[model samples]
Target: MKHQPINGQHHVSMLTKDAKQNLWFYTEVLGLRLVKKTVNQDDPSMYHLFYGNRNGAPGTEVSFFEMPNAGQTRKGTNSISSFSLLVPNDEALSYWASRLDSFEVPHEAIVSIGERKSLTFYDRDELTVHLVSAEKDNGIELVEPWITEDIPPKYVIVGLGPVELTVREASRTKAVLEDILGYTQVRTVPSMGDSKVMVDIYETGKGGLYTELQVKEVNDKDRERPGKGSIHHVAIRVKDVEELTEWAAKITAAGFENTGVIDRYYFHSLYFRDPNHILFEIATDGPGFEIDETFDALGENLTLPSFLEERREEIESKLHPIR
Candidate 1:
């Protein structure tokens, strides 16, 4: 269709029962850099944690909002069921399996997902995460991984991969992806675990490993009851505020209710929900994690935007130290 402003994934936001544990798992165990230490703008009392590659690139990040004492997720349909992180190749998969075992983290053995190998695991909050290989992918943009003594550059996570959404019916969501969002239906696969469950693959932006979306259709299932460990939303990339504004108009004209452009300090965003009521955000790629903090000092301090700087003391008082 017309020039598609939507790029690949921006970041997937999830809920965590303990920010401290979440920080440990994502940074120490998973080897992602703690890109930003900030509070959720919507609720300054709770902390919002961001983890990503060295640059905190748009497609590489996954964020969390702390919700202390929130109960376990009641899994079912109509949810952003899982999100995958991109690893370099099959060798990286093998390395991650060993690393995870040493850390006493439970993960399934590596298996083929489409044309690539994937190792599925859960976080402290039981958030489903897949470490998918980009071995067969040629179109995914490369980025700098966060390397540490335990995790070398070769085995580090590069960026976000496909995100899966489970719903009772897929027709409406498919329409939104294809008709409104300009994503093309690439293929469908019977679930590796259950042949009866079919997954439709849709791709936007560059239309490769990093840009894929999988929607699993299950006709009979109750809606999910989200609490801790549940995904809050999945955001896709827009070039900037100018591109985001155009996307807002397109989404609005297509009759989908949306949050008209909001300045998130780091980036501008527009939010909307799919037919299954799964939250989706379109976010810009600039004014990123390095705006306030130096490249060397990111995630080292409790950072607030200019608007929230005045309330830093009050915000810090409410948050439990994530270190």
Candidate 2:
């Protein structure tokens, strides 16, 4: 162990066309609890939705930037394609396959990558999602799941897995992931049936943070265009504000542009972009979703950061109601 800075993925944030539909899809379809319901701090006119486990655990978060009017995403090289979650075993994967089928949500049959079994699907915004089945010996993920009536606790998505980043080539992107972020390059493997395409695997602390780079030759004009159905950023985790600031200093020293430090109320944040312009965030583990509200009452009401406290009514007026 080379003293890992990033524990693993904290949360992945993306854009959605409709807040209500976003809510329904993650909560009703996927069975995630609406841990935090707030507005985008930068553009308070829009919403920022967060979905996580029962108590809004650290690695279980998947947030969104609800920008209904924004243009739709164009997938290509240099894009963060999908967000994945860890499932306990092959049986849990089978349960989810049938679960999504019953909901009429389109999903792919179980597939294999190395020794791992995965079930792929898309959310309402066309965001790609994967549920990877793993055994305890394969590093059983942080197992806190949002328990609800219909969704068995066994099948609830445990935590964030490898996020797929399809870039123009592997060199720059791999350097950023491995060199700058302190991730180890596990190996380079062939992608699908295309012997030309190389999928590079990078792993962080233990087995939590993983990223797959789908490297292919592409022209500058064909680079991915971020929009409605695209990922905003993937946040990696630090233990607390102290570790976060230290990482910030290291990131800046490594000749990368970082947003310094920000107070996100729930956690401290530092934002940066990789070599190919894919945004990345480094957020603290706590004070978490329970800072202001009780665990049982989490996400029950709209919450605002301290800076926006006085303008609550104004912010609420500009946004659409989501249940």
Candidate 3:
């Protein structure tokens, strides 16, 4: 197998109009633990909420940046399109379908995507989400689910699955994935009924649902007008800071301008945009969320990196309370 530096998706971040509502949908409705309650380091005026398993492990997180006045996202090409979460088995998919209905959350009937059955739905901000069964795949390791009284641990989302990237030209992004990032193009499949678009599957380390990146080639649509509910970027996991440095050099050698390595405090990160203008991040796995908060007290308090600690009072003054 060809060596790939990226393990799988670390986390997929999207835009949300309301942080409190976003918190409720993922924690109360979906049963993911609010692992980190912090502000976006780039823009400290707003919030960045992270949800994942009990530990907020790399592959399981789904995050959001609060954009208070942002409008609805306009769907089109050149976008991250949708993000999926893994369910333990087909039975879990069934449980989620009923759970979503009980909350009056509209969703599509479960349908087969490749060898796995997936149910599609939208969050409160209309961000596309899929609950895919991992029964047919044997590669990914399950993380400890955030235990909840109402939802069974078996049915809770285990980790993030294949992230769909819908772009005008797949070849451009394909070159970046395969040539620069060392990903292998695994297969191609028809999207759904009658659509001319073909979804190309690409895999990295350990090659399974969690490590796959699906690229949908669609030429008919316009470029996306990103706002609320639109994915900002998807972070790919690397083992540590040393490997991340190697990747920074590799990306630079490829002639693509990138944010060299950044100290995120929790995990170091390197950011770059693909040819389609879709932002991609390569992030380290260690020095995790527990660096600041204890495992049990993870997301309970407002946590800030050392540099931002000085401005905590001012930052808190600008933001609305979200709990």
Candidate 4:
């Protein structure tokens, strides 16, 4: 049976120890435009910052939560091993490498993944990040010198590229991505242990940025504890709000408890989990980053959702000052 696929890449959110440091790295160093700044609805003390291309568009954003003084996370089974970002091309990568060196940020030389080249590096809090030159044709806008100059933000993001996750039961998690999420098994490659299997699901094209679920050999199985530098959630994109609602029903029918549609200001969202315990969200592509702020003024200040607007004073008081 052919299953309906979701649309573009929505966003990926991470937990951070220092919001200010992350803001500087993403905005000043990485060249991602800060689109929105708000607080966690449930826990207003923590600030939620969204960074991406020109306007924090879907498939381009990498959001973060500022949880000050959070504990360290264990890198093992049931955790997202690594996350990747797609740059425009090799030239963009070279530009980034030189900039990182100038900033005194330590990073490895380019590494090859098939025809793709990547610069693997760690964030200030130790979250693994990869800036890869993807083969996809992304028409999105990009800020050149990702660290130095000011350029108009681009709209192209090759969706979410290959999220590497660590899981004890590889086959079970693979089933969820394939059978439930409609992802197709692309190929399997040898990794540190058994074999690194890759499953891909695309809404736009065959290639481009897709999720990569990796099964790592672990000595034991354990629940992942939330901590600083951990991926709080990885969001996949659906075409629109209607598709998001359909996925909510599909996810619940599959026996996983799903959070119904959520208004994330820019887009609606639904969240569920795979058997391996990684949190996943299905978000819409409409009502984009420019819904509230103009394209030019994207990452300028704190932007709040209407629900949190009434409690702005309380939220600001709780969050630590992050310049």
Candidate 5:
């Protein structure tokens, strides 16, 4: 049986040093809504914050891990080179340029990427961010929530953009993206060095939910050490639970180890590292943020999965309140 194409982004998870600062950066500065308030299951000592468009749609999400004193990430080889978001048009991009300026946020002047225009900036943790005038995303349609109603609807960020993944070799990565993940090569552009970089645009068309796998000719021996400002994993969207299983089979058959299916409460997930050891995830798009709270009350209080319900008090106490 044939399955759905891996759509655009499900979510991009990154590490941060302070939850409060990260919260302010995404929610207040970027005007995204904090839809989920929870702790990192792997390490309950840390906070896992989910920020995205109005209702926290799959492709729109950008989640963060908050660990104090974890240090900052160093940019080198085998890392997620860039992450971007989609706005409606150049006007929105201009508004962002001025909005960021008002906050004294240092950012790059608007730049063009392929056919789209974009403004680049850095979060408090120094993680790079881009706001692009998106093309058209024909992927799974989403009801983009404008939770921050005061912000102009046209200027609000709709979803994610193509994220660049850096790898030492392109052959294995190419095979995995095409055969295993089922992505088509959209275009290749001349980059800084030799061997043009491959650009794979998803149905995330207009929104730029694409992936740019950079083929590095020289193997830099220095490895990436994860801390603040580093991407934890880049997740691509799947239709549902069953499709996730199919992905697991295909991935394993291709000789990559995966985390199988994991219940993240809101959505199901399967994780595997790329040839470059950059973490990648395939996540379902359903049973989203509303499953736990009313649409109006999202991010208002602490939320725990059923297993962690008993320890809610302890968990709440440990986390410094951001809301």
Candidate 6:
């Protein structure tokens, strides 16, 4: 059976130690708006903060879970090692370099990836993130600070561009991405080989920038541990709930156990893993970040899923105070 093409990248969330620091980095530094602030349904004391363009649109949203007292993660083989963010243009690259310096945030010089220019930096929690400025061909609108007098209200994120993982062997994981998830092997970019094997995977998009996976070969795979500084899971987008269900079954049928459908309030999700031991999630685009709140008031309150609605007070109490 022919399935519908996967939608654009939806969102990516990370687990952090300090919610306030992450808020400042994503909102104040990177200029993403705080679209939602809610408590984790499973553990309410920890806050789930969502940041993105002004309205917290589906593809633009990037969320974080503030878990206090969590140990740092050793980003080695067996983890989603690093994530990249897309900027508008090269002009934005210069703007971001200056901004990071002015804010006293240490960052590396602009580096070239394929035809794009990127600035590599780590957040307060030590998660590696990159800002890439490339020609926008996906038709998704972006808020260019260098062009606007005021920060724009909404900028279409165009989903995840690429994620690099450290792994012991790339062949097994490569099979999962190709045979199971249906990603095509585009080409190898040797320019990114700084002691790692960087492979690109093309997913739902016009110019093949939606999803790319790079795996680095390492001697020890068991050294990596999941914790605060590592990615919990990298999510790929599907059209809607039905698409998500179909994809979940596909995953299960392929002999991988999926977490099943999970109502994330903003989107439904199912979790699984590739052969290399990196966690992956297939997420829906329906009932987006704009569901409970207006475009203008997206991050104004601590929103929760209906399952955790009755524990609002308890969840609020558990969260570390973020001023």
Residue-level error in angstroms, candidate 5, position 27: 1.0
Candidate 1 residue 207 C-alpha distance from true site, Å: 1.3
Cα error of candidate 3 at position 16, Å? 0.4
lDDT of 1 by residue, 1-323 (tens): 26554788999999999999999999989989999999999899999999999979999999999999799899989999999999988899999999999988888888875687888888889888988888898877878888888887888899999899898779988988888778888889865334467788898877887788899987677999999989999999988888888888889999999999999999999999988998989999989999999999999999998999999888888888767
lDDT by residue for model 2 (1-323), tens:
13345777888999999999989988988888999998889989988988988887778899998887878678777777777877767789899989888878888888766666788888777778888775533545555688888877777777777677776665787787778778876766644323355666677777533333333434454777788879888888888988888888888988998899999999999998877777889899899999988999999899998899999989989988886
- Ranking, lDDT, top scorer first: 3, 1, 2, 5, 6, 4
Task: Note the Cα lDDT for every prediction shown.
Answer: 0.88, 0.78, 0.90, 0.69, 0.75, 0.70
Give per-model TM-scores: 0.97, 0.92, 0.97, 0.85, 0.90, 0.89
Best by lDDT: 3
Lowest summed lDDT window (length 10), candidate 4: 192-201
Please provide the root mean square deviation of candidate 2 (C-alpha atoms, Å). Answer: 2.5
lDDT of 3 at 40: 97
- Once fitted onto the true fold, the runs of candidate 4 whose alpha carbons sit more than 4 angstroms away are 1-3, 135-160, 190-205, 210-224
Which of the two candidates, 3 or 5, achieves a greater TM-score against the reference? 3
Displacement of the residue 132 alpha carbon in candidate 5, Å: 1.0
lDDT of 4 by residue, 146-168 (tens): 23365223312233455666777
Model 5 clashing residue pairs (backbone)? 54-145, 135-206, 136-206, 137-206, 161-208, 162-208, 162-210
| Shift in Å, residue 120, candidate 5 | 1.1
In candidate 2, stretches whose alpha carbon ends up further than 4 angstroms from where it belongs are 1-4, 189-197, 208-221
